[model samples]
Target: MQQADIIEGIKGKYFQKFGETSNPDKVRTFRSPGRINLIGEHTDYNNGFVLPASVDKAVYFVIEPREDDQVILHAADLDETYTFNVNDLSKPDQAWSHYQLGIIEQIYKKGLKIGGFQTTFGGDVPVGAGLSSSAALECCLLFALNELFDLGLDRFNIVKMSQKAENEYVGVQCGIMDQFASAFGKEESVIRLDCRSLEYEYFPFPMQDYLLVLCDTSVKHSLASSEYNTRRLECEKGISILKKYYPDIESLRDVTPEIVAEHKDELGDPVNRRCKFITEEIQRVQDACDLLVEGNLVEFGQKMYATHQGLQHEYEVSCPELDFLVDQTINDPAVLGARMMGGGFGGCTINLVKKEAVDDFEQKMKAAYLQAYQIDLPCYKVKITTGTEEIL
Candidate 1:
């Protein structure tokens, strides 16, 4: 369904659950978009740069403030309901409700008062497809609460809070890119976010002749989360050893390819490989941005292919299925670039394909992918869009 249809369906279910308000002004609605990273995969947590944009797929909400401290939440798509009191927030009966409660916990921890509310929320963002639906939901609700409670928090504050909610409450050690893109994304633009300084700038996405296509592997390997943490630890171990040589080095972001090569023996084994990929990927992001500025899409696409090689061989995050999908686009004239996106192991491969050839590209890939893996591949066609904001 289109985003407008999704919004209309959520609105209908919302009004069905909670009667129409006496004063319509008291009601609020919001859209929080899922994100796609064009390049710079796994570079965020290393305190590096990422090129990301919000997608049309989003988590939407219709909220109305309650007179009391009670908060009522209804998941329109799942047909689930969760209730909690502002005074006594605890573990939610539903797992997905934690994203909302996480925001509330962060608010209370900061000594901010947030009035309770009821909301019906759902979206078309495909979960586990590497589209960052969780971040979308968190940012969507946090933005709505910021306005609903008249809290003095700004957009960046909303981004950080949403990240903290996932890191602390949901126990995910994700970096700021996902939440940042969801909160600050602009239409037809991709953000170059400095994960270290929390600074960002938008580059007009020159996709007028191209299309962004995400092909799902439909398999999230069990190692996705555990190995994500392992990669972080490995990077940390490499940095800790590097500190002996250069005490000022904070993260892989601070080191360079030359520095990594100079200390290859000391960095050791997979640590060296991990740092190699990260340091190179960080530089690639800078190079890619420069190419983007010059409108050198062909070379920019080459950088994407390089990223996939590093992820497949050096970083060791790409699975067989992910690698196969990317390999298919290597020499295809229609496809400019392809890389595995998100926490890795298995998910979607984000591809830059010519708008004219997308149909044939999808058909060919689907046939080959299914013949190889015996699993159907689902492709998502996407466009860049604005970040989280209230619609009403």
Candidate 2:
């Protein structure tokens, strides 16, 4: 979007609510980009590689500083209001507001004195669709607060705080990849992150002829949370059992596929299966990085398909809806490969499709999916984009 268009949009939205250009009461605005994990799902927590980019969709915030120590927040989409006092910063029962509150509490714990503010925020990203909408909201709020009080926090600091908010307050044991990508992503490049080391390198994404298409399965398995934790616990168990032999073994990441195979019989069926999935998944992540850097989209897409199969058969994370979507794209001339993305259960199947066939592929896939499931699927075509930045 053009700068003029952005200014117009911000002014229109701001004035419509506050009805003033300048006020003794200060105001600020900020935006944080939503992200799409290009590849390497469920590999982050295992200390493996992941490639993600911030997408075009984002969370926008218009905040006005207040003299008092009380904070007021209003969600444009929810049409709801929330109030929080800095002294009594506690989690909200409503759950959604806690995402914002959690960050504020963490920042204050770091000895930053923050005055209260009223914020009006809205965004277009779909929630719970594996698009990192929650990260968008939390990161934007962190940035706005940093500027509001002259906190002097760097980008990396902000990323850590945002991750802390999600892990401790939101109760999701996510890795740093999501928030890191949202804070530091560059346009047309995929970040190759070493999860164990927190080191990273950027490589140009050679997806020129291809489009990134997301197909929402419209089915969020209620067991996704429990199952995710279970899988994590299982990985930990495998690491524990292996540590008896290899004392240096820390995470499942420390054990290679070869090592797992050597001791495959030592582990029970479930533990061996979990270990196998993670070990192979990590290898695929490395191969994916090499393929993209070498500009081999075909090879990268094949790795993606293999990763999906491992997640389905060994990890047992894929569901019927996910399988159907991948099955539908098996022989598709347009799609090189399709697989379930995110923590699995049901969310979206990320696909590499020929740009020329995107429209027709969408029409055909939608008709077939709806015919089988009798529900319309939401599709998003995304291009690689930069992360959060100040509009001014």
Candidate 3:
């Protein structure tokens, strides 16, 4: 369904439940979109750069003010409802409600006056497909609260609050890129974010004949949550160990391949490999940005292939299905380059494929891959779209 129809559906459901309009006279709605990383994966937490854009897929929240300091939420996607006193501002019931509770908790912690409200939200962003469904929900709640309560917080501050909610309250050590893109992304432009500086610039993703296709392996990664934390810890451990020799280093971004090579023996094998992937991934990010700027899709595709190889060989994050998906498409004339995107144990493979050949290409991949792995992969045909805001 279209976003407007989705919003109207939620409003209709709320009225059906409450026997009155949630917004007595009128209601204010807020929207926040999910993001797709065009390139530069797994480099965000390492204090590197990432090229991501907000997608048309989004979460929409319709909210109405309340007199009491009690925030009430109802989500159609999960078929769940939650209520919490804004004065208390503690964690909500665990499970699906935490994302919304995390946003409220962070907003209160920011010294803003919390107010009571009723909200209903839903969206079509495929969960666990690496399209950042969580960020869409968090950002929607944050934006709704900001507007409903007249908190006067800017977009960046809202992004930070949402990030904090995810990091501290929701217990995800994710980087800022997801939430940042959800809040500040522009239409038809890829955001080049300096993760360290929290500064960004938008660059046109010079469109070619290729479609940016996301093929899901239908494998929900069991290691995604835990392994993600472990990888971050490993990177931190590498930095801490290397700091003894290179006092100037903060993250793996600081240690070049040359520096790591000099101290290769000292860092041991595991740390060495971890540091190696990070440093090289950082450089690839810079190079990818340069290539895109010069309208060098061919070179960008090559970098993407190299990136997958590094993630598979050096980072050791890609699984068999991911490996197969990428390997099968490496030499396909219609496909520019393919790589496993997201937390990576198993998820989607982002491919740049010739638009005209997409239908045949997808059919061939589906038949061949299903025969090889006995699992059907879902593919998303996406276009670059803007971030979210309220619609009158």
Candidate 4:
């Protein structure tokens, strides 16, 4: 569980993969970050807004070029490596390899040719915790490849290609938020991304008296993948209906609370609920941005609570574990806001808590969560950080 915080640790892993005798000068190391969505959830794919920040947790790539068209990859944490020719790449039996292959496939689609390389990669970001570990892996590989090979891919292209790999290759219909945050992150700031336009603005996140913490549920619902796809379909279905009546409403970003309220009968049942939650969550992201500018953490925290209720009741994405974590914190003064993050049938609940009371909050939350589920809850304290970069 050693996070890739230092060059020495990951570099040591590089030697483990390439052998002690391998020439060290030929290798380069890079780190790509995992991201936290502060307010907006399930809004990215809908072409809505999302507020996300890169955290300390990340995936590290220690890579060196190969003389041939062979791609040899080592999953440092898994202690496994898979080799393949760059000439013929496809999804492998190993799931982790998909992200790497997918990125290469994207490069190929652009008619770009790259020689073979070897990389050893691992991440400190906890998997299936709603923090984007997959995106971190994708960003890590893409950034390293772009730099190592002199691909001339700019930052925006890097973000887009990373997302494409996950969408087409990994089979996760994720929005650009994760990859965007990982590639474009800045220290002490959160990026407000417009999924439709792909434009972003940074809002200073001076968490003077609070900390961003995630309470891991330690439960990854089997239905999360299937349910995530289902939810996207539901939103699209809602959009189709709305388009018939309101030609101006192209995506969920264009949806307003008033629009949903007026069309409840036509939108119908779950679709109506789906659109309602998405539209509201989109507005909440905007509201959150303003609060950041105003430095009003308390009101911003309230918006997060509102998002959870929308997700739980309207979006139907919450499982009991997620709800339990958010519900238990409602009355606690130390907690400013709490909500389930990511596509979530099960995952972490992002919490804003008073810094001095973090110890008290953790003590109580651990005891309560353990008693409820017979499982230990893990809390991650994250700091906003800059995007992917070389270790040197």
Q: What CA RMSD would you report for each candidate? A: 1.4, 2.2, 2.1, 1.8
On residues 159-248, what C-alpha lDDT tens digit does candidate 4 reach at each position?
A: 899999998988876778888999999999999999999889999898678899899999988988888889989999999998998898
lDDT of 2 by residue, 1-392 (tens): 54345545654565566565335346666878878876777888888888888877778887878778888777777767788786776667777798998898789778887887777787767787888888888899998889888999998899989999999888877789889888888888889888989888998885679888999998999889999999988898889889999999889888999988988898888889889988888888788888877888888888878878988999999999999989989888788878998999999998989999999888988998999999998998877777877655
Give the Cα RMSD of candidate 4: 1.8
- Against the reference, the lDDT scores of all candidates come to 0.90, 0.83, 0.82, 0.88
lDDT of 4 at 159: 89
TM-score of each: 0.97, 0.94, 0.93, 0.95
Ranking by lDDT: 1, 4, 2, 3
lDDT computed for candidate 4: 0.88
Q: Between prediction 1 and prediction 4, which has the larger TM-score? A: 1
lDDT tens digits by residue: candidate 1, 85-186 = 877767766888889889898888778998879999999999889888999999998888888888889998888889999998888877889999999999
Q: Is candidate 2 or candidate 3 better by lDDT?
A: 2
Better of 3 and 4 by lDDT: 4
